[model samples]
Target: MQQLTIVTPQPERPKRRLPKWLKRPLPSTEMAFTSNVIEDLNLETVCESAKCPNRTECWAQKTATFMILGNVCTRPCGFCSVPKGKTGEILIDEPERVAEAAARLGLKYVVITCVTRDDLPDGGAEHFYECVQAVRAKTGADVEVLTSDFRGNRAAISRVVEARPDVFNHNVESVPRLYSRVRRNAIYQRSLDLLKQVKDEAPDMPTKSGLMLGLGETFDEVLDVAADLRAVGCDMLTMGQYLQPSADQLPVERFVPPEEFDELGEQCRKLGFSMVASGPFVRSSYHAGEMAAEATS
Candidate 1:
């Protein structure tokens, strides 16, 4: 006689869901107004291009971080969702358009950032200066410029420093160990040099750098990066959880809990960072105006 045998298949595990704290209500009318203003002036923003999780909330508050020098980026960083490709013609009218958008929105403080434009001679430094000047001329609002490293071109960095934006921010994006995988084509030392150069050129100008966590970096590594920034006279720091923009980008290794962020923020403050913003939803330009004001004050 033969014995009968039976086997049952195992069920697949469900995907990890975003925690409750990350959820938000649907867009409001204020968001619609912010979108309309940006569209009317034909301007671009990092919020829309990067698929930032805080876009809905920031727009609903009638605030946005404008992205200049065209939305197409030259670098293909693994963690970013901004479109990357060959450079396009410089939009000569972009500065004025950004000014108009800021004026229409009644923004008291404007934060302007740009995609990496390595193809250009100065990495768009002169354009950044013009945009800052135009915004100041139009709205009389304090302007903050978050710029690329300009490939560590001293002349290019000096140009923007001379423009005298209220704050000069360049994000390190990740710790040194993860730079190769997280920020391709970016050198960790070069970024540090850029921040140092900004401070050296204009000691009074507040310099800022940011990092995204949850990329397999240990807690000590993040603090070490902060120490490096502090060594170079970085005046402000922003830490945030890295979220995958799409399937093609790097997947989230972990969803860092809010309490951990709070601990990191406290640690950074003890390291002497004048202003620190750390949390799941924090972005380089998130609450940028408030950070600038508080840091400078």
Candidate 2:
């Protein structure tokens, strides 16, 4: 096999001029509802914090992913916009609030994720588990939890697996070559290993993962990563065009045309992923529960 490489056209540092399209749409009524629910419960969410471009569409569709625990992260990565610092302290009431927020939103699909809380003994794994359980009891949404690796703690991971969320997501943000450059604080193989453990523990659950493109990642590397996920029995994957969250963040290497994303998604399906959600706007939790449902069926 010929070696494949992603030849990225090195773009200049960062463009200050925002494209008219990138200008955010006015906050819709749904954003208000979602915000109120979050604020009412005193919860934090990636949808609101990271400035995810999908917020208006996802919220308008009545789906919002929740960020559990506090918003402050223990580790900072270049590709992310989540606030990072010394995690002040765990909010004892957070899990219940998340459950309440799910109830208030009437969400049929809920995505729960948290900061990398290495400060705690269980790495906050139990908190994730409880949040899922709470949401299930309150709103009964099909659950998906995108979690940290718990520093590769199998026992801590098992605590989450036992809850049996409908979908388990662990995003390897980029390939190993770019891991250090893009997500320097994150360990590439550990993310792969974490997904493996999720599948190993909950084989019946639809296991899913995602990757961001245009971080100078080669298309072949994307395909190879897809193959790697399939080899381990991951059932679903999401591929999306990477957007530089801010000027300080990594710049986009290539536009990654829509046709190419379509081809990649089809090839990943051929590689044995039960389902693939691929597009410019797709994110880690993009239509997550629907894809997981498809995978199970």
Candidate 3:
């Protein structure tokens, strides 16, 4: 006797939907004012460039992280949407413009960040120093600079540290296992080294770093990163869910629940981080002024 068996194949599961926690109202009137001010000054903001979900909220609050060294980034990090390759000529007057924009906005705490200019000799560290200086001189406000790894050049890191910004930030971005896929051009240890160097050079000046979740990292891995950050003397930490900037970017593996962010924040505090911002929409510079005040308070 012969028996024939036919097995039915299982159907594919559908992709996860955009969680309710991730949705928010569109920009308000205040956002228009901020947009006009930035546009009038011919400035670039990471809010718009990176398609940050919190843009409306941040802009309405009249705060935005100024993106210097032009809108184009040299690195092609899979999680970022900032334009990459052939960024054209550098804007020498950018520092002054940033200061002016901050002054116009009447900001008390100004945060400045830049594209990764690997093509440049100093990795744009000098320019970052100049921008921080200009912001301080013009507005007399507390300044924070979120910079690149400077290709692991101690001299370059020293250049920015010499400016003595109120806060020095360089995001580690992801865990070691995901570094290759999420941040192909950056090394995890090198980033940790950058934060450690900042602490060693200027112990009083707060050092900060950020990470994006939902990029296929495990819960234990996130805790490991928090421990590593603490080991390096990082004063502040920001953890947010990774939102895909575009169709071409890496897909989100899971939408970390808001409750999870609360738990992570507690864990970060346990690790001795003076300040921690963790949520679905928290970015490196989101509510940065408040974070700075909280950390120093």
lDDT by candidate, in order shown: 0.91, 0.83, 0.91
Candidate 3 matches the true fold with a TM-score of: 0.93
TM-score of 1: 0.93
Candidate 2 structure lDDT: 0.83
Best by lDDT: 1
Cα lDDT tens digits, model 3, 247-271, are 7688899999999999989988999
Q: For candidate 2, what's the RMSD?
A: 7.7
Q: Count the clashes in each prediction.
A: 0, 1, 0
Q: In model 3, how many backbone clashes occur?
A: 0
Tens digit of lDDT per residue, candidate 2, span 48-149? 777788888877766788887688888778888888887877777777888888877788888998888878888899888888888898887888999987
Candidate 1: C-alpha lDDT: 0.91
